[model samples]
Target: MAELKEARVPDIGDDKDVPVIELLVQPGDTVKKDQGLVTLESDKATMEVPAPFDGIVRELKVKIGDELSEGSVVALIEPAAAAPAGDAKPVAPPPQPSPASGGGSEVAAKAAIPATPAPATAAPTAAVVETPTRSPPVAFDADALMPGKVPHASPAVRLFARELGVDLAQLSGSARAGRITKEDVQAFVKAALAGGGAPRASGGGGGLDLIPWPKVDFAKFGAIESKPLSRIQKLSGANLARNWAMIPHVTQHDDADITEMEAFRKKGEENKDTKVTPLVFLIKAVVAALKKYPNFNASLDGDNLVLKQYFHIGIAVDTPDGLVVPVIRDADRKGLLELAKELGEISAKARDKKLSSADMQGGCFSISSLGGIGGTGFTPIINAPEVAILGVSRSAMKPVWNGKEFAPRLVLPMSLSYDHRVIDGAAAARFTAYLAQVLGDLRRLLL
Candidate 1:
C-alpha cells in the first residue's frame, strides 16, 4: 500500500507571505525528488519550492497566481509502493499515445492489412504510385500562433515589445531551447520596422505613430482626477511615513578640511595602478571612529537598545525607482582598497536590482552621500532600526585664515542624523566632530 503525504511550502528565508508566481506540476503527474514544484516571488528575490520525495502527485491544492505563506499545503503526493524483498528497483512504464492514434491496436492491425491488387488494363502501366499533394506552408500570422510554453521574460523586455506593438509569438526565439531573449526581441523589433511592415517614429515625433496615442475623453472626469499607487510604491510610502513619524530625528553639522589628506593621496598615487576615491577614505575613517565609539555603530531593538560589536555599514544607493541600502559587512576589518571595491560592487548590484534581501539587512549604521550631486548640505533620513546615519556633502573651495592672511582651502560638509530617543544631541555632535577630524588628518585613517 502507498502512503499519502502533504507537500508543504518550505521556509524561504525571512519573508513570510510571498506571492506564488507559477505552478510547475499538476495532479496525477509523477515527479522526482528535488524537482521544482512552484515559484515564490518576494520583494527581494524569487525562489523555487522543490518536491520533498519521489512520488506521484495525487492532487494540487493551489493554482498559479496564488499568494502563499509559510506552511501552506502545495500538493498531495502518493509514495511509490516498495519493491518486494530483494527485487530490483521497479522500472517506470512507457508512455502511451493518444487514444485517437489507436496506440497498441493500430500497431497490431497494420500487419493484417491486405495488399492492394493491381488492375489488368493495357499492360497496367507499371502501377504508378501517386503521392498526395502537400499544402502550402502557413504564413506567419501574429493572431494565429499561440503563446509558447517557454518561461516568461523580464518585465522590461515584455514592455518594450508591447510598446513597439511587436507580437512575440511571431518571432522565432534564439535563446536556449528556443527561449525568448532580450537581444532576440530587440533585433526582431528593429528588423520588423525596417522592412516597412510597420511605420517607425522618431523620439519626439508627432501624430498617431508615436505609441498609437491613447484616446482621451475630457468630459468623463471634469472635476477630479486620481490614480492608485503600485504595490511597491505603496509599501515605500508607508515605510517612509512610519520612519518620519516614529523616529525622533536630530541633525548635527560639521566640516572636514581635506588639505593634508588630499596632499597625502596625491603623493605616490599618480604612478600606482590602484586609484583611490574620497569615499574610500571616508569609509575607513567611519570604521576607525566606530571602534572608539561603539554606540555610534548600534541599532534600536524594541524598547531596548542593541549595541553591535560587529561593524556593518549600509551604503545608500539611489536608483530610478527608489533608494536602496546595501550593507557592507565587517567594515572595520576590511582594508581601504577592499572597502572601496566592495562598495562599488554592491552599489552597482543594488542599482541594477540584483541585490538580495540579505544584502539589505543587518546594517548597524548607514551612510548616504549626496556630495556628487552638488549639494552643500542635506539631512538624510535615518534608515529604520539604525540609531544613526552619516551624510557626506559637496567639497568646496572656502577661505581659511592662515598665520598671515586668508587663503582658499577645500572644505567638505558633513551631517549626522541620529535617533534622538537613543542617542543624545551632544553624542551626535561629538561623533560628527571626530569624523571631521579623521577626514582632516587623513594619516589617522591608516592607523
Candidate 2:
C-alpha cells in the first residue's frame, strides 16, 4: 500500500515569507529521500526544501514567486516502491567549462613551448550556426498576471540577467520545470537587441546603446543549416563579451632570446624524472616578475587595488567541451619538475572533465602559451579580477649581432596584455624587458 504525505518546508531559521525561487521537481517525477523539492530564497542565501521520504510527486502547491513560511506545504507526495540497490549510487554531473581571461588555448605539459591561445575557429559549413533555442510560450496563467514576480533562477543567472538589463519576470525560462539558465538569458538579449522582443531597461550595467544585430536569411541565397553553440561556448561567450567591453586593454609585444634556456631544457630532458618545458620556466619567471612588480599581482577593487601576496598561475587547457583554466597554487614555491608534474595532472583532469571549482580559482596571474601552434604574435585578453595576462608565441631562429659577429639565436615572441587603467606604457615595457632578460639566461630563473 502506498502512503500519501505532504512535503512541507522545514525550519529556515527566523526568515519568513520566503519566495519560491525554483521548482526542482515536476508532478509525476520520482525523487529520492532528502531530494530538493523547491528552492526558497531569503535575503541572505538560497536553500532547498527536501522530501521527507523517497516518493513520487503528486502535485506542486507553490509556483515561482509564491511566498511560503516555515510550515508552508510545498507538495503532495506518494511514497513509492523501494529503489533498486543499483540505483543507490549517485552519478556526478559533467563539469561545466568556464572561460579563461585570454585567447583560449590548450596547455600542453611537455611541449618545447606553451600551446598558443587562439579564438575557437568554426569548420567550413554550408551555412551559419545562428539559431536561438527558446522554450514554448506559457498561455494566460498566474505568470502572466504577475508581471513583477520574482524569477526562478540561480544567483549566477540573476547576475547575468541584471548585467544585460533584463527583467527576468518578463522572460520565460527554457530549463527544466521552467527554471532559467544562462542560455535562456542570452537568447532573450539576442531577441530584444534584434527587435524581436521587448526593449531592455536603459542605464543597466551592460545596457549599451547600440544598433540591433542585423537579422539575415542566409537560406535565401544558399543552402543553410542551424547549429547551436555548446553549453560551454555559450557561457564562455557571455563572460568574454562582458570582459572585453568593460576592460581597457593594451598589448605590449617583445621577444626573448631563449637559445641557452632551450639548450638547458634539452640537456635536462636526459633525466626523464626531471624533464621541464618552457612553460614551467615561464611560470617561475612570471612569479619572479610579479615579486619585482607587485602591481601586476593585484586586482582592481572599485576605488582600491587589492594586491595578492601569493602566487597562483592560471594555465588554460583546451578540452573537448571548451577551454578551462586550472590554477597552480603557490607557483613561487614549486620547482620546475614539480610544476611540470602538476601541470600534467591538471591537464589530464581538465580533459576528463573532473576539474572542480577550487581548481580554477585564486589565480593572481595567467599565462597562455601558443608555442605548439605557430604564431608570431597575438593579443590575449585580460581575465577580470586579475589585471594582466601573458601570451607566448612560437620561437624562431634569427640572426643577432653578438658584438663582433652575427649569430643565429632562438627568439620567442611574448605579448603582455594589461588593464591600461592599472598599468602604464612605460611599466609594461620595463616588465617585458625584465621578463625577456630573465628568460634569456637560465641562471636568472634560479635567482
Candidate 3:
C-alpha cells in the first residue's frame, strides 16, 4: 500500500508568515521527492519549499499570496513504496543564509551569487540545469520535453524568474526545445552581469507580456506635433531605463556643512586664471571617502568584486543636448585648485559637445551635483560598472546646535545612492556620515 505523505514547509529561519508567491504543483499531480512545492518570499529573500519524499499530490492546502510559517503543511502526498533507491537517501536540508555568500537573501536584479537550487518539479517539463556540479539532476519522463515546440517550463521556474525581475522571453532557453528553466534564468543573469549588461526588464518592454503601447492620435484632444527624440536623448534613455530596472538602488540622504569650504572658494575669485568652485572641493572630499571605503570604488564583475586602486571620478554635467558625465581622471592625485581648473575645462568641452567617448570612460565613482540648479535632495541612478554615485544639492543656511547655542551653518544636502547588492544599509549610512563629516571639516583633507 502506498503511504500518504504531507509536504510541509521546512525551517526557514525567523521569516514568520512569509507570503507564497508561487505554487509549483496542483492536486492529483504525481510528484517526485525534493520537488519544489511552493516559493515563499520574506523581507530578505525568496525561498522555495520542497517535497519531503516521493509521493503523489492528493491535495494542495495553500495558494498564491497565502502566508506560511515553518512546519506548515504544504500538500498531502501518497508516498510511493517502490521508488528508486536514489529517492531513499536522506535529502540534504536546502542551503541556509550562507556566511560566505548570502545566496539566500540575494535574488532579483542585483544578486550575483547563485541562488539555492530551486528544487525541480515532477511535471514533464524543461530540464533544469544543476548548480555546484553536485546537486541531483532533474529527472522525470522524457516526453515532458517536446522539441521544436513552445519553450517548456514548470510553474516553479516561472515564479523564480518573476522574483528575479527577468524577462523570460528575452532569454535563450538552455533546455531541450528551447525551454526556459530556473537554471536558465540564473545563468542568464550571470551572463548579463559578466557582459556588464542587465537582463532585459519585462512589461513595457519584453517580459511580463504587457499590453502594447497605445498608438492613439493626441490631436483629438489638442493640436500637437510629434518630435523625434534627440540623439543624446535616445541614447541616454535606453541606458537609464536599463540601469533603473536592473539595479536595486538605495539612497542615503545627509547634509554636509561646507561653511568653511565656501569661504576658501571665494578667495580664488581674485585669480582670473584659476576660479575655484564648491564642486572642486566636493570632488576632493569624495575621493578621500572613496579611499577609506575601497568597495565604493569597485564594480561587481560576475561573482567577483573588481576593486580599482586608482580614482577616476565622473562629474555629471548638464549640457544642451542632454546629461553627460565627464570623467576627471586621477582625481585622487589632483589638488583642489588643479581639480577646479580641470573641471572648468572639461565642463566647457562637454557643453560644446567636444568630449570623446574616452573622456567619459574609466570612472570608479560619479558625482551628480545640482547645487547651482537647486534641489533639497534627489536620488541619482548609479552609473553601471560603478557601484555608487553621490548626488549634491544646493547649500542653504540652517540652524545647528553648537552644544552651547544654536548657530547658523551653511549645509549642503547630499544623497548617496548605491547598489544594495554590494552595500548594506549600515555601510551606506556610515559612508554618508563620513562624507558629511569630511565636508564639514575641511582640515580632514590634510589627512
Candidate 4:
C-alpha cells in the first residue's frame, strides 16, 4: 500500500512567508522526484521548490500568489512504496532571520530529491489530507517580529524596511492575514516621519515614507478599469524605485571618435560572417577596462565591498512590454565575432519574449544601447547590485582636429552612471575615458 505524505515548503534560505510566484504542478499529476512543484519568488531570486520524492500529487494546499513559510503544507503526495519515511526528510523549521533571498535560515542551494526512481504506473485512488500545525508564539523582540510579520512584502519592501530600521509591528497591516503590505509600510513611515519619529534606518532597515500612490478617479472618468501588473513589471517597478530612491546616482558623459573603428568595419576584409558594430567594440573595450579596474564590476555586501573578477556583461534589449537584460557570461573570454553572434541571438530572443528566466539572471555590468534608436546620450539606471551602467548612443559625424586640420569624424556619445557611494567621480570619468579610447582604437579591439 502506498503511503500518503505531506509535501511541506522546504527551507529555501533564511526567509519566511515567501510569496508563491507560480505553481508548476497540480493535483492528480505524476511528478518525478526533484521536478519543480512550485516557484517561490523572494526579493533576491526566484527559486523552484522540487518534489522530495516520486509521487502523484494528491492535493494542492496552496495556489498561485499564496504566501508560505517553512513547514507550510504546499501539497500532499501519495508516495511510492520505496519512498522514505517522513522522519527521514523532516520539514525544515521557520527561519529566525531571513537571508537576502528571504526564504529561510538554511539556504537550500538546490532542492533535494529522493534517490529512488519513480515508477511509471499511476495511482488514481490516492486521497489528499490536510492538518494544521501550531504557530509559534509572537516574539516580543522588535527586529525579529518586524521581519517575521513582513514576509509577504516584495524584496524591495523588505529592503526598504531594513534600511529604515522601522519596526513593522508599529504599522497596521492591510493585506489578508495581517500580512504587512508595501503600501501599509509606506503609510506607517510617512505618519512616523510627519510626527517626528526617528529617521528610518539605512541599508536593509529603513522605510520610505509613503509618497501617495498614483490614483485615478474612475467615478469621474466613468466606466474605467485597471489590471494588476505582471510579475516582471511588478519586480521591475520595485527594483527601479528602490535603486533610484536609495542609491546616489551620478552621470558622466563623454564622446568617442570612432572614425578608425568605422573605417575598419566598412573594409570588412578580415572575415565574412563576423560583422562588427560599435556596440561590439564597446563591449570588448569595457571588458578590457574591467580587467584593469575590477572595482567597477563589484557589488555592495552590507558594510563590506565585494569586487568581482569575472565579467558577465548584460546587454539591455528592448521588448514590446519592457526592457530585459540578457547576460553574455565571461565577455572577456569571447572574441568580437563570437560576442556579436551571441548578442544577436540573445537580443532576438529577448525581443520575441522567448528568453527564459535563467537568461536574465546574472551580470556584473550592463550596457543599455540607444544608438540603434538614434539617441545622443541618456543616463540609464544601474541594474542593482552592480555599481554602474553604461549607455551607448548613436554615432554622429562631428568636426574634430585630425593632427593638422579640422575634419569631420564619426563620434559616438557614451554615458556612465555610477553609484556615488562606491565609485568616485574621477574613477567614473577615467573608466568612461578608457572605454572611449578603446572604442576609438580598432587595433586593440581586434587583438
For model 4, residues 1-447, the per-residue Cα lDDT tens digits are 356798888887788878986676766665656766777877776666778887667788888789988888988898743333332222232222223333332211112221222234632112111111223444322222122323444445555665665655455556654557778777776665455564453433445445445777777968866777766677777788768876889999999998988887777637767666667878888998787778898998866889987899999887767778899998988987888889889988988789998898779999999998898888889998899999988899999997999999998999999999999999998998888888788566555
Better of 2 and 4 by TM-score: 2
Predicted model with the maximum TM-score? 3
Off by over 4 Å in 1: 1-234, 266-275
lDDT of 2 by residue, 173-265 (tens): 887657789998888777764558565444343355445567898999999889888777787777677678778899999999999989988
> What TM-score against the true fold does each predicted structure earn?
0.48, 0.55, 0.67, 0.54
How many backbone clashes can be found in candidate 4?
22
User: What lDDT does each candidate get?
Assistant: 0.69, 0.77, 0.76, 0.72
Q: Give lDDT tens digits, candidate 3, residues 76-96.
A: 887744332233222222343
lDDT (0-100) at residue 135 of candidate 3?
31
Model 2 ranges off by over 4 Å: 1-205
Q: Of the candidates numbered 1 and 4, which has the greater TM-score value?
A: 4
RMSD of each: 20.7, 27.1, 14.5, 23.1
Candidates 1 and 4 compared: the better one by lDDT is 4
Return model 4's CA RMSD, one decimal: 23.1
Q: Superposing every Cα of model 2 onto the true structure, what RMSD results? A: 27.1
Show the colliding residue pairs in model 1: none
